[model samples]
Target: MDTQSITGATAAEIADSIRTLHERGELRAGDALPPVRELATRLSVNRNTAVAAYRLLAQAGVVVARGRAGTVIAGMEAVAQEGYAAGSVLRDIGTGNPDPRRIPDASTALAGALGRPVLYGEPVIDPALEQRALEWVGADLPGRDLRITVTSGAVDAVERLLAQALLRDDAVALEDPCFLASIHTVRLGGYRAVPVPVDVEGMTVEGLRAALAAGVRAIICTPRAQNPTGATLSPGRAAELRAVLADHPYVLIVEDDHFSMLSQRPYETLIGPEHRRFALVRSVSKSLGPDMCLAVAATDPETAERLSLRLSPGTTWVSHILQRLVLAQLTDATALQAVAEAGRHYAERNAAFAGALTDRGLPATAADGLNLWLELPLEAKTVADRLMRRGWLARTGDEFVLGEQRSASRHLRLTVHDLTDEEAERLIDDLVDASR
Candidate 1:
C-alpha cells in the first residue's frame, strides 16, 4: 500500500487504520511500514504522531522496529507455551515438569480441606494459609508493611500485578531468555518489553541499567532458579540491583520465586525497604505439584489493595477449598519432608546429567532447578533434530528467549530427573552422538 493510503489524524486513528489493513490482508507480516517522518508528511500529522502510532502498533505486537531496517509487521502466531508438546512420540526431556513420583500425596490434605462451607463476603484467604504464608514469605522481604494475596499460580499473579500497575503501552523490563509465561503475559497485555540480559548471577547490572534508562515502568525478576537457565541471583548482584532500583522507588518490582521451596540456592531479593512498589510471590507448584495451582504474593499495602480490587468478593477470588488444601499440605510434616526430598532429588539428577555431559567434554552446569541448561558445540536445533531421530525430543534455548540472542540458542533445557538409570545413560550417549 502507498504512504497516502495509511491515513490518520491521530495516533489511535493511524493504528486502527493499519490494523484494519492487516485484517484485510493488505499489510502482511514482514511488510515494512513507512518511516515516521515520511508517514507524518503524507498524513499531514506531526512526526511525534507517527511515532506514537507506531509505538501503539509495536506494543500490540503488530509491527517491530528494526532500527535501520525500519518497522515491519510482526508474525501473529500463538504464544509458545511450556509443558509437553502434543503428538510427539519421542522420549520428551523438555517438558519442564517435576517428577510426579516426587509430588507429595494430597489425599490427606484433601480430607483436611473438607470443612464447613465458605460463604460469599467472607475473606478470600484461608486463615491458616495466610498466617503460614506471612511468616514464610515475610522473612525475606525488606519492607516492613507486607500484605499477602493469593492467586491461581505464579503466572496468574504476574499477569494481575502487571495489569494493576501498568498501562497498555507502558514499558516493562523482562529478562532476555525469560520464562515463557512472562513473555506471553507481557505481549498479551499489550505492554512493551525491554530485554534485560541474564548472566550466571541472574540479571546483569548493566542490562538492568539500560532497561531502567529505557523508562521501564515495571520489572519481572526470577530471583532464584530462573527458568531454562537455572541461574540464581547472587548476593552481590542482588545488592547491586537493589542499589540501582533504589533510585526508582515507584517502579513496580515483582519477584517470582517459582522454585522457592525446591531451590537449592539461597534466596536473594531486589526489593529494598524504601522501595514503594514491589511484590514477592512464592508458588507451591514446584514443591507440592502443578495441580495445586496456588501462589502466595506478599506486596506493599497499596499494591495488595489494588490486587484485592481485581480479586474481589463473589468474583475473582481464588477458591477457598484450594487454599485450604495447600495449607493442609504446608502444615503437614510428612508432606514438608517429601518436598525437601524432591528438592534434593532434582538437584542430584540434574547434577548427574551435567556431570555425564561434562565427562564427554560438553562441560554442562547443573545449577539449582529441575532442568539442565546444557551448552553444546553444535547448534541446539541441529542436536535436537538428531536427538528426535534417536527417540528424544528436547527444547532449544531459543524457545524461552525474547530478543536476538542467537548465541544463547546453542544450549538445551532438558528435564531428566524422572529418567531411569538406563534411559539417562542412553540420553547422554545420544546427546554426544547428536552433538557430533
Candidate 2:
C-alpha cells in the first residue's frame, strides 16, 4: 500500500480510508498521519474537511494528536487513569487521591444502610436519600424546578447529561486543562470540545463567548475547586458568565462540583434564574470514598426526564443499598465532622507546601483543593525527568490539556495533601532542585 495512495474527498471517506489502511496492516500503531493542510492539498478537499476527518479518527480512538509532535496511531493507554501508578517505587506526588485516613469509615453505616429489599418496580432513588439530596443541592441551585436523579458517579451524570442534550459531533464547551475523565468522555462521545481557558477566577468570559459563538450545544463547568488549576469561580466572574449565558437560554449547562464537600471555596454557579437547561451534580466519591459510587444530579425537569430514560428499570439504575449507605454517612453527625476536618487537613497541607515553594522562590499558590497546580519556569517534562532521578513521580500538565494549549503547558498538578511533614519538606527541596 503506497502511503501517497491514501486518499478521500469527504471527512467520513478519509476516516474510512485510514481505518481500512490500519486493518490491512499498512498503517501500524504509532504510525504518523499526514499534516492536515498537506493532506487537504493532496486529497483536493477543504482544509476543514481534513481536520474533521482527523477529529473523527481521534474520537473513534483510531488516532491521537500529540500537539507539535502531530497525529499518530494510538495504543491502548490513550485514556489517562487517576491515582497511583501500579508497582512504582518512587514517591508519588502526582496521584490525585484523597487521604485514606480522611475518608469516613463506612463500615458502621453500611450495617444500617441495608434497608428493606427494593423491588424492580420501586423508585430508583431511596426516599431518605432523595430528601437529603434535595436539601443539599437545593441550597445552591438557582432554579426552583429542580429534579434529582441518582447516578453511579459524577462522571456518569456528566455522560448522561451530555447524551440527553447532544448528538455526535455537536460542539460542547469544556475547560482547557480539564479533568482527565471529562476530556476522555467528550472525545469518546464524538463531540467537538471548545476549550475555555481558566484563570484564578475560573473560566474566562472571552473564552465562553467564543465557544457560544461557535455554537456549542452544551457546557461543562466546575463551580468550585476546578481540577488541576484549583480555579474557583468568584461571585463577580460567576455573574459575568451567567450574563453571557443568559442570551443562550437553551444551551445545556452541567456543573460537576466534585469537590463540593471537600472544597474550602464558596460555591458560585453559572446557572441564572431563567436558564432552562442545567444540571448540578454532586458525588460522594470525593467526600465519602471512591468505592461509594453515587452522585445526586439536580437537573431541570425536562433533562431529568430525558436522563431518566437511560436509568429506566431492567437496564440501569444506581443501587438503592449504595444510596442508603451514602445517606447514612451524609446524615451522621460524626461522619459530617470528619468530612469537614478532612477539608481543613487538605487545605493546611497544600498551603504549607505552597509556602515552602514560595520560600524557595518558585512562588506557587495553593488555592482550594486536594492538589497544587504549580507552574514551573522550566518545561514540565524536563522538570519531571529531574524529579524522577531524585525518586519522585509527577504528572505533567500536558496530560490534562485540550486544544492548542498542550505544547505550552509547563504546570504540574501535585497531590501533596497526604504527604507527611518530612516528606513534604524533602519533596519541596527536590522540586526546587528539579526546576533548576
Candidate 3:
C-alpha cells in the first residue's frame, strides 16, 4: 500500500472519515465496502490501519463483515426521495394527504421525560406505545381474539404482512383502483395483485369471489374509504364478503383501515372468528398526521408472530422517540379531540367541494375521506387539462387503478383540503364547462 498516497491518517481518523461518509449518505446500507487492502492502497494508510478502521465501524453497528466475502454498510434505513421532485411545498392539491399542523403538539412534560439516555439495546417497540395502540384498535376490533403489532407505518405493515404470508408469484386479491401503495408494494415484492371491482357500497362480493376463483392465495381489502373512490365498506357488504371467504378458510385476509380515525362511516371488519389468518392495519397519516409515520397492525397471534420476526431488533423498527411522542399525544383527551376535529374538517371540506361542483351542474360524488373522487362527464384527462390551465394539479383516477384499461373512469381524485372558496368555485365552473 502507498502510505504517501493519502495523508497517512491514523486508523481512528480514517474510520471517522468513513463514518462521516456513511452519515452523509455517500455510502448506504447493503453497499459493499472496498477491501481493506484496496482501501489502504487508495487512502495511503497501512493495511493494519485499514483493518482497524473497518473493525471500529463493525463495532459501532455502522457496518457488518462476512468472513472471506467482505464488509457492507448496515443498520441504515431506506429513504426513497421520489415524487417530492415537484418541490417540497406546492399547493399540494394532487396528493390525498392530511395536514401536518393537525398533529397534536407534544406536551413539554413528555419532552422533558426524554432526558435520560435511550440506550441502543432497548426493546424495538416500547411498552407504553404498544398499550396505547392496543387501546386504539383493541376497542373497535370485532373479534376478542385479536392480537396487536405496531409497525413503522401502514406501508411497512402491508409489506411485512405480504412478506410473511406470500411467496414469489403468489396471487393476492386487491380492489381495482386500490391504494397506490398497495399496488406498488405487491408489484415490488413480485406478487400479482388480482384487481377486484369496488362498487358504491365498497368492495363488491362478486368481485372478491371472482378474484378468489382466479386462485388468489391472499386478499388485501380496504374496509373504509377505499382510496381514490372514498367508498367505505358497508356492514351489509362486509357480512356478504365474510360469507364468501368463509369457505376459503386457508386464504389470508388483510384489511387496510387507512382512514380508520377519520372515517365518518360505520365500523365494519370482514375478519370472521373462524377465519384462520388475518391482519387489520390502521394508519394515522390522514388524521393525526402523515409524517408521524405510525400504524397499528392488529392480527391473530400467529400473524403477529410472523410480523414480529420482520420487526426484529437488528431489522426495521419504529423509533422509540416517535412512538413515545405519538403515544403521549394520543393518550391526552385534548389530543384525541384534535385528531377528531381535524378528521371532521377534512370530511366537511371534501363534501363542500362536491356540493360546489354539483351546484355548477358538474357530476359529483360526496365521500367521507380527504379527497373527492369525481366522475366526470368527459375523460378525466380533459378535466385535468382544463384544471391545469387554471393553475391546478389533480391526480386522475387512472393513476390509482390496475389493468390494461387505464383510459380511466372519466374520474379525478381532487385533494379538497387545499381548495380555497374561490379556487373551489372556479374549479367547479371549469369542470362544468369542460364536461359540456
TM-score of each: 0.93, 0.88, 0.78
> Which run of 10 residues does model 3 get worst, by summed lDDT?
76-85
Candidate lDDT scores, in order, read: 0.90, 0.91, 0.77
The 10-residue segment with the lowest total lDDT in model 2:
1-10
Residues 65-182, model 1: lDDT tens digits = 8899999988855876888889988899999999989999999789879799989889999888899999998778744789999999999999999999998779999987889899
Q: Whole-model lDDT for model 3 versus the true structure?
A: 0.77
| Candidate scoring better on TM-score of 1 and 3 | 1
**Which structure among the candidates has the greatest TM-score?**
1
Number of residue pairs clashing in candidate 3, backbone atoms closer than 3 angstroms, sequence gap of 3 or more or interchain: 0
Estimate, for each residue in 57-163, the C-alpha lDDT of model 3 and write its tens digit. Answer: 77566677776779887753332221322643334466766766666666653684364555556777778877777777776665557667878788888999999
- When summed lDDT is taken over every stretch of 10 residues in candidate 1, the lowest stretch is 1-10
Ranking by TM-score: 1, 2, 3
Q: Over the stretch 1-436, how does candidate 2's per-residue lDDT look in tens digits?
A: 3357677889999999999898888988888899999999999999999999998888787888889999998665577878898899999888988988999999999999887888889898888899999999888974478899999999999999998888777899999879988998997787888999999999999999999999999999999889988999999999999999999999999999999998898999999999999999999898898998999999989999998888986568988888889999999999999999999999998998999899999999999888999999989999998999999999999988886768667999999998888898899999998998
List where candidate 1 sits over 4 angstroms from the true fold.
Answer: 1-6, 19-32, 59-69, 72-75
**lDDT of prediction 1:** 0.90
